[model samples]
Target: MTVEEIHGVRVLTVPEAGPAIRGGADALDLVAASFEQQAEFVVVPVGRLDPEFFTLSNGLAGEFLQKLVNYRLRVAIVGDISAHVAASNALRDFVRESNRRGQNWFLATPAELSDRLAGEVEAGPEA
Candidate 1:
């Protein structure tokens, strides 16, 4: 596991798919699966996501986001998702909402993610 701080957010990079699957009990399993590496937050590169997750449905995507929120885990997905963004209004809305909440974010690049996170940290807790 690799850890770095962007603004006030601690970002951890782990092997692809490692955090997405884990075996255990139900809710505990979900939490454990989501944070096996013990990260305060994580940035999952777009390439790291499975092809099936490309479409934002009420199923997998929702479940994933729910787990992240449930665990109070902040995530920033970095990549070029122009096609995905263009395909669904709902997905666009979800992305917009996530960015606004400052919990989940979608950035074109790691540098952008770093800059935005730094700005948020400078903006202070009231933001």
Candidate 2:
């Protein structure tokens, strides 16, 4: 894992552990490690995500989201997820709710991520 701080948020490039291999414990471990290192937020830029990875059909994504909400750790997933989003209504709803709640964000590029983080910083805590 590589962590770079941008606008006070830690942008993390996590290793490709394969979607099928990740679970709730693994998500917790990653979040714990990031927090231990003093990250206010963590960004995972996955190159390719299997549709199953984001599904509520038993995977780490849902668990990780719940953990993030419970712990108040902001998270963002950056990459192309058009196919996955198209595959499941539940996942689409998850993305929408996460973004609406401001707990999680999803973007397609690094520049967009930086811009969004900057916007968040400017928007302040109430945002």
Candidate 3:
């Protein structure tokens, strides 16, 4: 819904009120929108995603994220998923590894995401 540049990272921030994103189709739709908007990243609120997305066993997260990566678009799931992480060690690991990879990030807040992008900018495009 809203597209803007944050710390030099052009991002398409999905609106909380939009249609429910259930699977890869929805992910692809977002990818298309990102391209149209010339955004390199798609930042979706954690609440906008399905409950299964938080459960690594469900594979929805993998399926959905793969689509975005395939299109060369990075994704950041922004918001608190602390409860979800607390429940599953695999998810905890997933989130931690995702954060390090820099392609897919599980950030606690938009402010954190902004800080992340700011760091990336300072690191330069070669990073």
Candidate 4:
């Protein structure tokens, strides 16, 4: 794991080589990792998450995301999730709405995350 600040958004990035995250327990560990760094956001590579993570019907995403929301911690799942998105309209809609909300984002790259934070800063406190 690595922690860095991009455009004043403190991000805790999970290592690409890290173990696959399977359930809420594993997801919570990632959130917990942020506390030590005082990071406001977490960047987890798509490869780290289990296949079930993308299946909204399975409820893992909701469970894990709810935990992050409860902690007021933002997160970006960085990578190509096109396959998963294509597989289910619910997931597609979920990702779309998540990106719109700004609390949780489905990003294609870390640079996109920096750009999103920049926009949020410019949008001010209402954002």
Candidate 5:
């Protein structure tokens, strides 16, 4: 577990070697981990997310992500979800909407995240 600061936000990058995040409870565990590390953003790589997370029909994505958001933690799902998006129009739409909301982001790469958020970080934490 490593938290790297990007665009003034401390991003907790979940390690790829850990157990897969299987459900909402697992997601909350991550929230706790972030708080312990004093991180404001939780960056989850695609490999860490279970396949169910990509299946919108099960609502795991909603349940899991909403829990994190409710805790006031920004989230960045980093990886290529193009294959999943290609399989479901609803997912494509969800990804588009999530990016626009700003509180959450579905970025393709670390470099892309850095570029997209550069000089665009919120001026304050509202702390």
Candidate 6:
């Protein structure tokens, strides 16, 4: 992982290729990894997550997101998840709501994440 500070948001960029993150424990490991790097936010490429991560029945997505929330750290799933979203309306709604809440986001590129961070900075304390 490589850590970069974008608009004062410390972002840990996970490698595009690695062991798939499959469950809550794996999600916790990611938080630990981010803490070790002293990063406040993690940017995980979608390819690194298990296929089941996008499937709500597996509960992996909720478990993982809850872990991040409990830790008070933000995360952005970075990459294309259109296929998964297309396959499940529930997943699409989840993504939409998550984005609306602003604690986490599903972004397609590093540029989008940078834009989010920048926007948050511009929004000031209320953000």
Model 5 TM-score (2 dp): 0.91
Reference-based TM-score of each model: 0.77, 0.80, 0.95, 0.95, 0.91, 0.96
In candidate 3 the C-alpha lDDT for residue 16 amounts to 85
**12 in model 3: Cα distance from truth in Å?**
0.3
lDDT (0-100) at residue 72 of candidate 2? 68
Candidate achieving higher lDDT, 2 or 6: 6
| Stretches of model 4 off by over 4 angstroms after superposition | none
Q: Write the per-residue lDDT of candidate 2 for residues 28-47, one digit (tens) a residue.
A: 87678777777767666655
What lDDT tens digits, residue by residue, belong to model 4 across residues 1-127? 8999987888899999967887778768977899989999988899999998998888988888888888899989999999999999999999999998978899999889889999988889886
Q: What is the lDDT of residue 61 in candidate 4?
A: 89
lDDT of 3 at 104: 97
As a whole number from 0 to 100, the lDDT of residue 87 in candidate 2 is 88
RMSD of 1: 3.7
Candidate with the larger TM-score of 1 and 3: 3
- Over 1-127, each residue of candidate 5 has an lDDT whose tens digit, in order, gives 9988887778898987878887789888989999999998888898888987899999989988998998999888999999999999999999999998777899999887887667475434441
| Candidate 3 lDDT, 1-127, residue by residue in tens | 9999998779999998766676799999999899999999999998899888888888899999999999999999988899999999999999999999988999988999899999988999899
Ten-residue stretch with the least lDDT total in model 2: 15-24
- Tens digit of lDDT per residue, candidate 6, span 16-55? 9889988789878889988899889988899999999999
Once fitted onto the true fold, the runs of candidate 2 whose alpha carbons sit more than 4 angstroms away are 16-21, 48-51
RMSD of each: 3.7, 2.5, 1.0, 1.0, 2.4, 0.9
Residues 38-76 of candidate 1: C-alpha lDDT, one tens digit per residue: 666777677666555656663666666567777787777
